[model samples]
Target: MALLEKLTPGSGSFDNREKIQNQAVSQTFHSAVNFVNHQYAKGCEHIDESTTVCDNDILKSLAFSQMLDRRCSIRKPHTSTCNWILETDAYKHWLQQSTGIFWLKGKPGAGKSTIMRFLYNRLRGECRRSPEKGIALEFFFCARGGELQRIPLGMLRALLNQLFRQDPTARQCIREQYEEKSSAFGYGERTWTWQPQELEVLLQDAIVTAAQTQPVTIFIDALDEAGAQFLSGLANYINQLTTAAKICISCRHYPTPPYIPGVEVRVENHNSGDIATFVNDRLKIGYLTEADSPDSMIWEDLKADLTKLAAGNFQWTDLIVPLVGTKIAEGESPEEVRRCLQIVPDKLGDTYRRILQNVIRQEDYSQTFLLFQWLCLAQRPLSVTEMRYALAAKDMVKSPHRIRCHETASFVKSDERMKRRVNAVSGGLAEVVQLLDGDKERQIVQFIHPSVNHFLLTEGLNLLSKLAGDGKELLAHQTSATEFTSNDTVQRCHSNLYRCCLNYLLSEETPIRTELGQVPGGSELDVRCKSSPWHEYATRFLFKHAEEAAKYRVEELDQGIWL
Candidate 1:
């Protein structure tokens, strides 16, 4: 009313009383909107202030870099229905209750992440519709992203950060912990990470604060990826936290979390329809171009066989769907594709083998084996550009120009050749895609699925080695092919990797447009060279990888490599 009075013309009196009243009504509505906007801005400022006290310069670097918006990718649209759980009475009960834990468990490639992502999005949408429901904290664990993304400390900090964004006052517990650590030996004398116990206290404080107004939800996906330590005693923490908040989590079934009273949903039982749908849709987009006109009987037959073979595994569908495209994309009739599908098995291992047999050309066998060996052994997924440079590295014994007065670059600048190399070697098993590392785009090459990772690390590499005809295994897996720990393969792969890295690091650059050591800007030129994707990786990891490799000296390794 005051704002309208200040803005209105001739407030004291109006010659046309009826027109004045109408103008006042419009001004009053505008005044209300202005007040709301002002309050919103003030609220935002308050949140910014509160979060600062909880922030640490180092921990800030460890902040959930891409997590805030990193939803589980179904990869392609309509690929995951993920609605089975929502229809259950248990899910409905948990929603209305709004103060319990729910655990969804599944196998490695059973689309657990997909289901969890769907639920997270659905809950978020509901919150947006009625924000009075309070804030939701969601984090998807990525094992390849390093410790900051897949550990207890990271999880706590991310969860706390999410809560602080919603209720500014909820940061009190974290602020106290920050101050305690800072003041232990004087201000800023010591830096510390929040232990799980301390984090639990802080989480409790946040949940209580948020719950005072409305329900708060926590969604954690890929618990197994966080490692066994995260799994231990996690259920107890969640059980305790849900005393004031609601939580949902999903992980593989091994090294199982503590048994807590909650709705337990097994993924495979609920995913058969979704897997079939995904298979049908994917093939239609990429494979099934021609109709019954070519071979109507087998086309339908292939679809039925594929959906049956899937057996509720989406990863199986992923490998199988592309096989349908191999012949079809080349303008082969549906008859040819059907014949190809006939030999591909329902089992993951057999299917992976078939794909390998197709892509491993007779001549490219050794090259592809070496390429895959580097991939199977890399500590982290190598960028496509990194793989290109790494692939072209020459062993110390193999290089002709061992002694040089001046250094040359590793390989000639050949972007087109590198792309073809990655395409041919990756086959359909690996993906070369643009991923954002912080704010910049990076092109990385990695296995298309976790099953691919398993197969390669275990049977896939061995299969390739068998084709190599040395009858030698690079590394051996335990009783279970999928288990990654306590294996000699790590050493075997690392030694070869060390030699590979060492060579790539030492290889001289052959100057193309610019002369060797030429610089447009002195120190700035060095910084620009440091910016090459491969340059920093080689510089950083060359020694570290060699150290891991040195632990075990393999007889097969070249003596020159020992240098």
Candidate 2:
């Protein structure tokens, strides 16, 4: 009788039970409504406003130098390009899915990175416009960059950091976890490190918790570049996350991903129109855009031929289009340009080798070779200013009589001019990019593509050496420096760099200035960089290069040590 009475009307326990059920239903209904409304809304002015985080230390710790270097370096997709993917059923379905995986596969030099950048930007824009529940994050894997850029651990840390920024609850969870781990390890903030397992668990937890309220989307580029050791496990984990989040990964066709449950889009299959449009726009031929022109058919045919030749390799098209444009500008017939394309090699490596041979003359060989060495083996990406100083130091090292630092004014002229010079010397294999270093902007040099870096390191280096002749004085401290065996090329390069760093540091003419800069509000480091760009790099990496040089024990080091 007492239990029946408690369950009846005016019973406190029954009223509480009914209220709890109603709250659960209401929460579910609101979540569903928010999701559908988000999908249908074509335009929105704000994404979920919860992503902003005030905890600077955690964010800084999670982000590493050069984390965004590769992404920033990618060329923006041309207008009207990469729009085909947005209309695809697979893409639309993936976007609507609460949890899904989308894979974009391509051949090397097929413009996969460019496509990824386009998609990331587009999605980010969409989320920003939608005053709904969505978060967008991206990471571009750079094989030629620091270890963190090419590893799974770095990817996890970056993604988790981004997640914490967007989700306050997750951020609080991270802060608590960080404190607990610090206490357990008895390590100060400086000594604390994030292990991979802990990050993985935290990411899973964050995703699950975040999904209850909103959608999270992540774009990862160049999975093949990310270390192969963890790719299979990583793919599996990502697949599991599809229960709550959406992921898109781009990778080269080879070293195929171990798991294959995701929707796969072959880059070449869908990018032919984009290639044709790019060629037509970039070829610079007359009447190419006029649909009604009598001669337009001829140009269209020409564009088609080049597009077919590209075989979905946009990089190949990019190289050929400019060459064709140059030929046409020089008054060469379209037939001649077509003939030129026919002779060019189909393989990207060979294509690069050919471009290098054509652009680098005998007099420019040593500088070109040295530039490649620096790009391939530097401790970090070189800023434009540092590269200019490096090349200058090389010449000064060769002819000590001219070992004087030029004024900053002289450098200012070369800042823009040097970019052209670098392109000319490197056959467009290396390019300068402007990116943010905290609040400051820096122009750094990197290879046009990772394949270019690989080619130079493996085949291009030896080819340049053979072409330049054996025992050549390549940035030698002394004329009679040691010859480089193919086996010791890497070490010899490091040794040469070590020597250069020493010459740069010990040279009495080279100023390591301490005065405040003319530019107001500049940091001390910025002032130092403006006055002497190479000083910071040479000081920081002198020992690092020296250690690498020790592997071969170059005699140059002994001379450098004494000098």
Best by TM-score: 2
> Tens-digit lDDT track for model 2 on 1-563?
65445446666644677768766866888899999867645332222352222255567768898778999999889778999888887788877777778988876677889989998988889878983748888889876789989888888888888887787656666765665665576644546778888888888888888877778888999887765566688778777777888899998654446866768788878999999889878875563344455555666688778888776778878766877767766666667867777443346776577556643556667778878888999998898878887776565444425355453222334688888778767755677778899999999998755557766766677777665554565555546434456778788788778777777777643333334323344455455556777878876787789899899877766762443
Instruction: Give the 10-residue window scoring lowest on summed lDDT in candidate 1.
Output: 475-484
> How many backbone clashes can be found in candidate 1?
6
Model 1, residue 401: C-alpha shift (Å): 63
Off by over 4 Å in 1: 1-80, 183-193, 285-294, 331-563
Question: Can you give the lDDT of residue 126 in candidate 2?
Answer: 83
Please list the Cα RMSD from the true structure of every candidate, rounded to 1 decimal place.
20.7, 22.0
Residue 259 lDDT, candidate 1, scale 0-100: 78
Model 1 per-residue lDDT at 47? 21
Per-model TM-score, in order, reads 0.51, 0.52
